[model samples]
Target: MKIFNCAQFVRNLSIPTLKFYVAQHQLCPDLMIDWSQPEKNIPKALFSDIRRLEAVQADELTSLEKKQSITLGLVRWQDDLKRTFCMANDSAINEFRHALACDPEATVVFGAGSPEDIALWVLVYREKVFRDAELHLAFQAKTHGKYWKQHLIPKGLDITHDQARLDKFCEEVAQIYQKVGAGKSSHVEVTERAQDGSVQVTIYVEGPLTVIAHFEKNQFNRLSTRIALETALVYHPSNGIVESVVKGGAKNHTAVLELFGKHIVGQEITPDVVEKKEFRLNALRDEMLEPVLDWSKHGVHKVRLRRAKFTPVGRAGVSFQIDVPPDMDKPDAMEEAKENLRVRHYFDAEYAMESATLIVYMSPAQDGKAEHFSFGIQRLGASTIKNLSSKNQAIAYEVLKALDIIDVLDGPGNPVAEEQPESVS
Candidate 1:
């Protein structure tokens, strides 16, 4: 059958995604963890177990083509692999979340899983979940041609009976599209009306993982259409990943006929929204222009504010500049670890809490084996983080005032006075 529509594309792509992973030697056959789960507290023993199968680099996904199943596997997580058994799982996601709760400025957390196995999956978790689920439903449905005839229109072209409907839909999609950013980091947005009066959205994103998916503006009765529409969504802010259609600008999706329903346009350049879809279009377009982009592959440990001078206008941005030291390539694992921690201390000591402004001060090095330094800003993406604790907020506000990121609008909000060194270092 000639496949044409976005739904057909998603349905075709996702139906066999799981069977693809079955061929890989399991790290732990006792466990049945999927792409949705975080890889934390994973056993150290799995390193050798995983390394023997395929050289799964950090955040790497290997897909072996199969006639029936889409065989795929995420490789081992990177860093401290030889020494640490506590790699990935629920514990790590939670532990990191808690630390950020206590110290929003803790710089140790954000860069925890640069190229971990779960990194690729978690980065695109939402994209996979809904698409996988929808494709599963499409695989299940065997609709009668009459249903397609009723929906396909005045001319008797039953959509479910032939591939022409898909072709027509795909053509319609090509003519109306928008992109917020350019490159691998950019998100391709498309919106279309279905025969059942529901609007669907297709977002194509290329990263360490490739996600091309579609969904409803909002949930509609499944009986209304055989396609399975999602009723829930989970948004993860790590690196500003957008998790739902509404988050992608699908407000009032059920209303239909809304032009440019999904666009990457965003107004808030505030630190909090910078990673979001709207703002990402402006800042990270070219970064994602490729098929694979990640820390292990790119040499960028993290993206954080290195230096900024605030003004009434938008915030200034500089490279956070974290890197492996030139000498870190030493064969001595212990020595390498010590060097990693030394780099960590340099930045973590200054911005102890994980706040939006907390810099990921890796002190950009020429390059080496040094483990990257992280400040747990990713935890702030938790929906639970409503506002900074009064104390931390005050602290952050003071620091922002010092940096002049924000003006001292009132009493006590003023930048705290600091004593200067007797002489320059």
Candidate 2:
């Protein structure tokens, strides 16, 4: 039994947008007052009011809003006409009621049921209701980690016991670490930063054991370091070596693996063999990256950088769109500027979209008050991004990053790299 709470509403949804969602789903009014008009649309006011209600319990709301907003919500159950009446009269209930008495489309129904049954009905209908709702709100706010849950579980640390092998691997890493540090280059400074500015080769052993090796280059400063690390080993687990190499920057970089030639207690220590394998690894890596490059060149995906700013809209917050492609249906390939690799992969997996204009507005703190802040990525081609899934939004974000259309900005709306000034106003 899932219910659409206030927090979910605020995540990226607006009143009108939700109304459009209800209309799109043709969600039945929570309580139909009459029988003749069985199919009725939930009043736009209902959704608008819900958006306003969100401000009551603002702290719980995920999006950054000024006022407090509510967290609870009602799951309307259609049992019987009498039950509908009973639920509606209680002002405490934000229950959906029949539209105005004059609305002939309203239908009167009757019955009694358990909460699960009520939830069942709501779930069946609300999915489409909310799926459409989710699309409408997706672009308005970054809606991740905000969801309805029946239970909660704490995540545990990600360490396993394969002690002995890991110990040996880590020892190897330490040795490599010491040697690399000893031979530091005066021209380059190697730091333990997360960027691919350097390549890392991790060795994973077969007891399901794993080890990591890192290789870094300071192109800007002209220096490089290669370091390897191993994990702890446990009982006779499947032992195997893991290898990974990461390269960064616009230019191609190469890595040379230097493994000391020494045979282990039972295994053969082959240094030259490992170096030869490194060449194969590099070639494979290049092959894997080819699809991303091809996609970008063919225009299957277009990247753009975006600068976004959040401004106060009444008690809520609104994000304005200053630079976006003219075609909204065309997915706005956007991403954070720092995530270059992620952006590249995003362009590789692409989807076709139609064009449309989506204006997202949130209701103000008080009743009858509303604020307009963000425009759904104006799909210039055909369908609005409002039709996309959260995953789709994520990919779209990555493409945007490749284009440098991320939310990051410099002084007073200055894009990070001004050379790519977007033609869209």
Candidate 3:
């Protein structure tokens, strides 16, 4: 988790990339004598300035002041790059530029941090600007792991679990990738095979950068355009669930699923048949019951209802938010409030429970240190766990799974339970 310095990142950049930025008047504009001919010595001055800023002693400024200075420096760098891209005439670049324009806090999107962290953000920003087309296609393919969504294939379908079928499916996916303009060159390959009778396939696509400026003379330019989108397909034969991390959006997701059905299952798969795993209001309530989750068994010491929000169905722009005291050990008050609202027809069968925040006190594990973490659970399967450490996330996922909140894929193509219409007693 070592963060690299921004100065080091800048120093590592190829001369051509530095020249490209300088030529476009993106860096150290005041030092450039001629806009037409960017001086090779400009990087030295730029590096010197960045190093000087990095060399500032901690005692010289307060933490807040240092952060403010770093933020301003990073924001200025991002703004200059954005301004240059905004003036680009290319359609793809223009589209990206428009997005950049819309995102006023683009520099801080990755979160404000140390100069090294900001340096990584700057690198990402540069890639987005220079290789907008490739990134766009990769993004379309859902290259980012966090955003990967899951879908279940019907167990009733006659799925042929063999190498031949998988090979054929990969071929079809490659063709589809090209047809969908994912890239100029595309290939699908088997990336991993799990011992649990699951296989992972990756769809890689490469295309030329959409920027108007040509960087043919630059050695680094070759890598800039080689978009290797890891659109993964992890098929679990045990339950017929295909965890898809695709590049394209919903349309492409459907297309790929259709092909998956046709090639592997020998059947036509429609959106209706492919079940999406999500949390239902009733399921949430059911899981909250004591019988479902034994806190002691799950190493949970205590649970507190922090907040709950609900919207009455058919009520336009109306919602209710209940904020519970975090220190309150008993959830009886929140439960009573819900009952009160339900009896009054405010939270009846027509009510849609949106989300709930919970503070869970976990029993000490091997580390032997008890900890309490807060997390929010949404109806659409998005749960926000405040502590982003992998261990904490895994624990959260485990707890949610135990509560039948997340990854609750029961049976093949089992649709998420619909909200039950409860008659007011």
Alpha-carbon RMSD to native, per candidate:
21.5, 23.9, 15.5
Give the TM-score (vs. native) of candidate 1.
0.22
Give lDDT tens digits, candidate 3, residues 1-425.
13334444545445545555544442343332332435455556676655554444233564776656654654566554443332222333333333454465554532443333332333445544434333333332342234355566654444465777777776666666665445655555542222234555556665334434355324434333444555566565666666666656776677777887887668876644344345643544432434244547656776555666777777566677776666535553257456656444434466677777766777878988888776666665445442233345545555665565555443222323211111100
Positional deviation of residue 280's Cα in model 3 after best superposition, in angstroms:
4.6
Model 1 ranges with Cα > 4 A deviation = 1-173, 177-202, 205-398, 408-425
lDDT of 1 by residue, 1-425 (tens): 13233222222222122223222323334234343433332222233344444443222464433211211332232222211222223333332333234443333423443322322222233233223323222211211111110011111111121234333433333333323222232223232112112222333332122233444334442232122122211112222212223212332222111222212111212111112101111121121112222222323443333211111112243323222332322222122223343342333222222222232222355684433322112211211111223333334333333333333452122111110111110
The CA lDDT at 191 in model 3 is 29
List where candidate 3 sits over 4 angstroms from the true fold: 1-174, 177-182, 187-189, 193-197, 207-209, 212-230, 247-251, 254-273, 277-293, 306-309, 318-351, 365-368, 373-376, 380-425
**lDDT on C-alpha atoms for all candidate structures:** 0.26, 0.25, 0.51
lDDT-wise, the better of 1 and 2 is 1
Best by lDDT: 3
Q: TM-score for each prediction?
A: 0.22, 0.19, 0.44
Indicate whether candidate 1 or candidate 3 has the larger lDDT: 3
Residue 50 in model 2: shift from native, Å? 17
| TM-score (C-alpha) between model 2 and the true structure | 0.19
